[model samples]
Target: MKPGLFVAGFILLFGHCTSSLVPKKLTDADGLVIRTGTSAGMCVGYCVFDYVLNGTNLTLTQRPNSVQSNLTTKTCQSTISQSDLNDLLGTVDLATFFKQPAVLGCPDCADGGAEYVELQLGEQKHRVTFQYGQTIPGSEALVDKLRTHRVALNECK
Candidate 1:
């Protein structure tokens, strides 16, 4: 075998072994949290937004895209009850995340911008990178809940 091949194989094997040493704490979390980032464009900078749903509280942050004249960033927040959070979770159990596709594939993205979704509960956390409106199955329910309460949230567009 070539000398370069031996070095490459050793590096790959070593990297994998080292990665296994890192513990996955998110998989053991007791509470549930969902974070999402949405953006459009083949590249970067185009109406970027982020959201975090923890316990009964919701927060939204947005930043203008490159095309936009305003460069300001905005943040908004709202709340939901623990029972309501339960209802949302009932629609989509946490385990479903384990079976989630690595990429949700945004069908609506004209040319495919970018979107990221992360779900955390206890020590289990799942993250997906997809396109706009193209998230995993069962996510719509949670999205709907957020939308229904969007009016109460600040800085979330």
Candidate 2:
């Protein structure tokens, strides 16, 4: 092979390989809460919730206004009952509790953006939003921590 052609091929291969290493941001809408950031890769799907914790028990209510779709302009409405919230709260730690925004991807739907979730906590009913994707390394560890917290709460009863 010609020296020039070999160099060109090497450059092309290097570019493709490096591109794969570059992380892409996953953005999604949670009703009025909108979050955007980069994730390790593309997201397949997600869910959003509004949660309130009382002692070791929690109530997670799905907010209809917190729905965002990347695949369709249409709005989606869903609810999470108080009993369901209690079950989820019992399983997770309320102090470290966080909500995830809905995520979707389709060629026919909108693409690109961060996923957001809004939560209302306590009697003050403080509202807060959380965005996922560009978090610290070890996504699994964070998830496990949350899961363990949930189990602890469940044991309280």
Candidate 3:
């Protein structure tokens, strides 16, 4: 067998194995609430964000130092379509997401920034925290979408 053909054959054979290894998609999203937010330690003026998601309603609350007289907490409300919510839920692999540790990396280390994504189902809950701008392995699509939504909400006039 030619060397190139041998390599290609090997790849094709193993690549097929990964098909079954794909994470399972979440099946039930009725009681699911996904919360995500970001915070910075050494920053001023609205350095903290708290996002809460319930059904199609999304609420974002931003705050700076309470002691600082110039900045105050701001709350914003937004609604996402059910279709959009379904799309976001479909990107999550609940099995893999729940398996992740409570803290993935050094979140907020060195005063850079920190972010967290949490899932609540019924009475069970799981949360993963990582450095800001870092992407989780299995839930990349969901996280990216949420981050974009947060940005849009913050930028809203």
What RMSD does each model have against the real structure? 8.9, 17.6, 9.9
lDDT of candidates 1 onward, in order = 0.65, 0.32, 0.81
Could you say which candidate leads in lDDT?
3
After superposition on all CA atoms, how large is the RMSD of candidate 3? 9.9
**lDDT over C-alpha atoms for residue 151 of model 1:** 36
Give per-candidate clash totals: 11, 15, 0
lDDT of 3 at 131: 93
The window of 10 residues in a row where model 3 has the poorest summed lDDT is 19-28
Q: In what order do the candidates fall by TM-score, top score first? A: 3, 1, 2
TM-score of 2: 0.23
Candidate 1 vs candidate 2: the TM-score winner is 1
Residues 1-157, candidate 1: write the lDDT tens digits. 6999999999999989655533233221246677767676544433676778887778888877767664677887877887777776665545556577877655335776676767775566788777655556766675555445543553555
Which parts of model 2 are misplaced by more than 4 Å? 1-77, 80-83, 98-112, 123-157
Better lDDT candidate (1, 3): 3
